[model samples]
Target: MVTRREWLLASGAVAAALALPARSAFAQPARTVKVAIGQKTIAPNLVNLLIGEGLGYNAAEGFKAQFMTVGGVSNAQVAIDRGDSDISTGVPSFALPILAKGEWGKAIHFYQYTYPYKWDVAVKPESTLTSYEELKGKNIGVPDFAETAFPVTKNVLRSLGLDPDRDVKWTAVGTGVAAGVALQRGAVDALAYYDTGFGQIEGAGIPFKMLPLPKNVPMVGGQFLMALRERIAKDRDLMVGYGRSVAKASVFLAASPRAGARAFLKMYPEAAPRGSSEEDAIKSVLLATARRIKLYDPPYAGAKIGSINPEEFRIEAQMNDMKISSFDAFLTNELIDEINSFDREEIKRQALAYA
Candidate 1:
């Protein structure tokens, strides 16, 4: 059964993208565009610039992409609203209510569905922790107090008949890396982190066990790609160009995982090893990154994965049962389709190269 959020988001996005007039407006030169990356370090979302920056795709299309750490999804939304950034990429579920507040108004449409590979609980490998019920009365650390991690953690706890508030003491440890360090140091009994952060801990030689979420619990709602709705409305070509850049990045990432991982490590040296060959470490990073990205692949061929579609409605229903307000806020593919058409040949070429 389709959930309300999927219907709402998809219908709204499609309607908005389709309603735009096709006539070209005034000519404008390339402008420096700023993007707000909510996360502290580089990840797949930066795949656009990681590839585009090196390949001059953004320049070829007409914009220089600038990135900065902007705290949580709310922070990125506020930044974009206050004109601190032009685009913001992060968790979509948390951003919806803010978007409904007209934060960026008609200037942005939330596009792109990132997978839910970012949230999980890890325990020290030495601990005999094999299940969620085993975590009762433990100290759990998460990046933020009110973020989705907390809720997901609560959901899991509830499913295991554990009250998170009463059974477990939760702390906000700031970054996943910090959480990993804390867990390794025995400061926290367990750390709630995502796939990449978990990769870091494993890479650091810390053996940890991931606690399985309850079978009935919902998969964490994924990240989103949001743009300035006004910019898209006023400058269709620029919007199309931005979309093309994203596609190019995704294709390159799929085609050249190792090279992509190398680029990723270059943007984030902290993600690489000190003595390992850059190529080897990058290949490791790329293999891991590719695995995570596959979770976001849309069901359709060459389709954007991980976004709200028919498959997520049931999850949304579960969220509603958990008291999450459900509405018609599904992610729409109209803009992506439009953008894909403009650069379909290039995308196909890159995909072929990667294949």
Candidate 2:
């Protein structure tokens, strides 16, 4: 026989015991993966990564991604080479030369972001440069002579019957805003870079005219996720996990890009400078996301989000004049196939539910 107080105390103890296990069950710690990005600022591509993290996609794959910004792809590669980062984003055309020369450890490209040869040659709005033909003998600013932009731009010029070496002058201007400054100051007659570079220039309120690359030229490769071959062999599970997480994020972005913008701003509030409206920042991000989404359609026909088209790689290698015994030396499809193995319908449903 127990008093009323004694009965209440027993009930409270039972409740505590039941709740403790539930809390512990939900509290699993996540593993951390360091990602080194080429650009210092938060672009739409970075926003997709951030949204994936915010939505626990990375954690679901047993990873907690930490993104570090080095100045350029070269810098990001240096960081990875030094073992300061686990993975880095870069262009295969740029990395291949280094790999061919044995300057860096062999790497595996696990993901593809943009289609090759998507760069545009742009000029000031008031300028008379209307065709690639006119660019001959004109100063064209590229991010780097050794990077993808230079070779792609050269191919475009060659296609137009212009001698890249003798007819056009190439200048290595810094990326995005810096390149825009070169154009604004009349330092370069034209600027050739990725869509993001042109986006940055337009976003800064400087109107510009762009000449699109010809569709006939073989597609050069685009940006990709790379890790040392040794790391991939040792940590295959982690690489597969990253692919799975990013695949889901890609579907989510395609379904709802606005949600991506909101997530980006929430994760990095500093992206919006002082006196700028949240709405404006969100719009900017959405625009960037839209551009990225376009890169996934049509030319890149596939179900897997990060699928690397072998033909694209072959074409890129040919364009860059590099010899590769096998494409497998640089890329692997195992992880991407695993990522696509997830229920496609369910992924689409999740993306649609973002709104």
Candidate 3:
């Protein structure tokens, strides 16, 4: 098994750390948390974080979220593992592999950031590839080889009766415009990535024929809010505060997706399209965020927002071949009640009044 230190050194954790230059957010901050995201782009996947910032949710919680993106989910997890960041958002599959390899004490996922399997495989316009089976021997362009899509693609191919190592070629096409360009120029035959990434790709004016997820793999869990176990143990208030803000942000977004998009643009004004009018830009963001918003719906995420569903993790580990000794070993719902301690109607009221 590769030790955590060895993996960090080999994975260029130092470089990843540098990419996320130190910055601060709140002035009288009780806690300054370094939050790592998968990609740098201002896509819908990150709108909740933006909402948290624009709406002052984090500030109200007494902690400041200093955000950074290292391009992929695995790298984001690595940021937490290397102590480059105190918390990160990632999938259970990404963290399980690390735990299966004995990389303990790195981090523990406590809150469900996203509530469903949001990844998908897509072929560019004019391609006849209707099924994932057609992906055999085809080039798959992903954001990163260590990303959630990488392992998910591998498992998907396996379930489709294809040998992933021998049947497919994978390339790191980054995200958004880079991914769109790669597919446009035929650098890869198919694009395997997550929800908001595809949203950005579509915004590039390149249509896509999305392939359905393989039916055999029972992957259910999605992105999560992860922090060190020690951090949660010693500083419970910080974890509860941060996650509570995120949960409220989720509620605010669900209450009004358009408002969420508006909040996103408000936080990152440059994210607004270059020549487009304000309403048009906000509409584009709404379109990009539509699918992701569905994942956080009441029916899918269930009544307890941000709570851990053990069955989901069990299925995730089983399908991905991670030897998880126990579901509780990697996650906890103990903080769920605390994280969700927010008034839904108040968030709805705020969303309605959002500029």
Winner by TM-score: 3
Give the TM-score of each candidate. Answer: 0.74, 0.82, 0.88
How many backbone collisions does model 3 have? 0
Every candidate's lDDT = 0.57, 0.67, 0.75
lDDT of each residue in 1-355, candidate 3, tens digit only: 2345655664464354433322224354666777888655445677775567657888798877777866666677678777787788877655666677766654878888777677888887788888889888899999877667777777668767789889989899986768878888889999988787788777768778788776755556477888888888998988898888888888899889998987777666677668988988887787678788877643443568777677777776676677878656678877888987788999999999976
Clashes of each: 20, 0, 0
Please give the lDDT score for candidate 3.
Answer: 0.75
Select the stronger candidate by TM-score from 1 and 3. 3
Off by over 4 Å in 3: 1-3, 10-30, 40-42, 297-303
| Residue 134 CA displacement from its true place in model 1, Å | 3.2
For model 2, residues 115-223, the per-residue Cα lDDT tens digits are 5556888888899877888887899999876456787778667666778889988899986667888988899999987765666666667767886555586676477
lDDT score of model 2? 0.67
- After superposition, the stretches of candidate 2 with alpha carbons farther than 4 Å from their true spots are 1-28, 102-104, 144-148, 159-161, 297-303
